[model samples]
Target: MTLQSVLQSLLTAFNSLGRSRKLLLIVLVIILLLYSLGPRLFGYGTYKHRYQDPNTACMAQNLIDFQSRIDNLDAFHSGDFADAVASKRMAYVGNGNIAAALGSEKGLYIRLNRALSQPINFWPVVQTRIEGSKKKSTVLDVKSGLAYKMQVLSSSSGCINVGSQLYAHRSRPALLVQDIRIQNPSTLPIVVEMDQIRDSGWEHVEIADASFTINGAETVKYKIYSSTVPLLKSDKVIAIAIASVSIESTTERVEANSIKKFHLLTAVHYTQPMLAEEAPKYLPDCIQQAKGELEKGLGINEKLLRQEHTHVWGKLWYSGFSISHSKASGAINGDRINRTLYYVLSNAQAPLHNVMSTQQDKTNIEKILYFPDNCYSGHSTLKSDTLWIEPEDESQIARVVTTWMITLEKLGCKLMVGAVKLTDPVTSVLYITSDHQHMQELKHAIHVKEINEAPAHEHHVIALHKHGHHFGGLPTIFWVSIALLIVVFHLFLFKLIYNEYCQGQERYSRSRYSL
Candidate 1:
């Protein structure tokens, strides 16, 4: 059939339908058209429609992506930048009882405590000197409990790459491990020196050559030993021992276009001498124990030790909480949060059962003082007549107010008076502890009359104004309900039209039969 004839036939069929059916057909067509065009017309698929802000959506997605990965760019620092060198401070690595704040360039700061303590710089624990190389980059792999650094050596004779991985053993809190790999890419051999320097407080420092048989071949190794004097005349003694192994020779050498690996394990032990006089007697045993720990750790495969360490860290990280932001600085904020958590985790150890508390005695509480003009005091009070307002100061005040309320509640104080007047300069004050006679004493001391309570309605209005209504605009639920209602209405209309068409058909049939 021709296109015009087919269109005419369809139009005739549509016209022959009853008014109710025709109306229903038109409504269905309109609904279909609207449904097809809805998303495009209303920007339903846009990020703004879904998330309200594109920046917030981007940040949320970035956080999610970071959580799924084992490593992130935030954990890496390129040594080529000037800031990298300037910002080189120690990053913490530890297993609950013992921790080390290790610097990217140099320094190993150690701490021993059940909880986080200030790390002591035991500089020169293990120093690596690559012949003619500079540091390339540093990576902190929090998931693997490892810190990595790369160094590049370029000379007219050859080019070489050196990498080092450092970690504190999770299971063995006193043990720290470092693995060095030398990659020589040119037709020339390179030599690297490894040094374990003794700190000032340590006494009886010794270095010895040792050998270990690996894969039925004897490997040359060296040990450096040191012990600290009795801690402040106490019976305790801290001894440290380091074991170093070179896969090839006493002097670390990487053959032309080949790789060589080196291993260093440092173990620490503390002697629990019962009497101060016995500290000397315990020193030998402490040194032996530290050496024994190093030996035990060295026997284990490096890969297995790394796997176990990473597993422990994985569990800790999984148990910890995560905070995310929706601002433009969300990634930076997330990185900061992660770093804080990492440092805290590095200083935490598994809690021991039946352990005695070592906390000092609580200080006695004397009097609670309130200083209304404290914010305006100090340099500002002396220098200027005009009042200056800062957002940071306001935030600090809010925090202080919150802390004060918590403190009062903890001290069995009942809030008897709370008032805020937003006139001129704005005044806010709180009076607590009506149950104690201190309130009267305070009133007398301040020479102030009793405060008159504001009307309840006025207070209510003020509260409402301060915390403005949080109406969340139109939500998904509202739109969903509207759609459902529209569907139900269409269904009812279709049923009504069907019933009318059936009745009309019956009447027409009867009239035709009577004729």
Candidate 2:
């Protein structure tokens, strides 16, 4: 407030920057030079829009033609397999065995759209990342950050107060967030906010006129609340919500209805998941069973090592999430960088690489899953690294349970699902976060022998049929009867043809010589 004080503050700031100022200025100049000479840099992309224009129709038609060409299997285009197989890691980890599988690399695609405000300007860029994955039926952790080239999207339309909370950017045009759906997933009670305005340290939103009728039906609210994607009971596509702020919460996941349910078909060829009361017993028995068959050269494929994979519908998110939290200075729009974004971004995260081998050296995890020592912990709220086994294989995967029961029971986790058909060899389980920092806790195992990569299968040797045929050799009665018949026939043939016929031939020859 005083000239001396202002002068002192300026001097202090200058002193702080003393030597570093030269380096900072040099860095700034280099960056300015690069951007001025650099090709366009892409940031986060916007929501995908439906084809509503004539050009869109033409593009759609072109796409259809291209698809038809592919369907015909024209030799000119070898196939999707060519390039993918070239990159042999083509086998998706998600589609492999649970215990032995790992998640895959992820990326975000970007584009820009603005009519007037940002003509010839770069569009918003989206930076996507795989937060993490779990073996649960739902819940995929995802983290995203954003950088803008063009301006952000906002509504010229009027805004409504969310819970009477006045945002720092109340005078500036507030953000207008609309339909935010949890695609292919269920609705969960998440802490939804329009945008965390950093300046005021409060969540804000632009909630207004988001409902519109579809096919003559009543317009629905933007957000759903369900354990699945509908966000509500009986509804299919829940309206999207316009929440600027969201806290860590649980929810159900949904998928495109077009995606069909995949079930493992168990025949003699299917891999079987073995369950036992003790690991020591299971290990020995499995080894013995496999060795016996290998020595005799019977069903040798029964013990080959295999990998694990999943067929999960992954979670979707964008980069603006971090940006909205970061740049929001006092009275600044959510699009600006601020403390909230820094807070959300300061930490780091990793994807799902389930505990395959607990060995000190995480070498190639052949056929086993090495879970955490406290995997079975009963804690309702677990740390980020914790694994949660679902209830389905409670009885069948008894070995996993029994081995880790002390920990699981203590943690208060329960089991679910129907009894084993004595046929299904694969087991399913869910792993969850024990703590909050971007959890991707998933545990999986495909054992040594495997079938499909979706989960560990139940494999049965073809020995039962082979055993019956092998032991059912020759019968005593039948063998004796055949021997007796052969002996009698031999004697009869000797008397009728050998002796009498030869004598007659000799007598006729002598009579002819005498005459």
Cα TM-score per model: 0.49, 0.14
In model 2, the Cα lDDT at residue 151 comes to 10
lDDT of 2 by residue, 1-515 (tens): 99999999977876777333544555556556544543333322334456554322322332343354333321011122223221221111111111100011221101111000001111111111112121111101111111101011111221111111010100011111111222111122212222211112112311222222334553322221111012112322211111122212232222322111111110000112222222223333433332232222211111120111111111212223321221211223222122122112211111233222345433434222353442432322221111222212112122222323223333322322222322122333333445432122112221112324433322222222223333233544346446655755565566568556897889888999995
lDDT of 2 at 26: 52
> How does model 2 fare in lDDT?
0.24
Alpha carbon lDDT of each predicted model: 0.51, 0.24
For model 1, how does the per-residue alpha-carbon lDDT over 121-189 read when each residue is reduced to its tens digit? 344335556764243544566665677655666644444666677887776776778887877777877
Could you give the C-alpha RMSD of every candidate to the true structure, in order shown? 15.7, 37.7
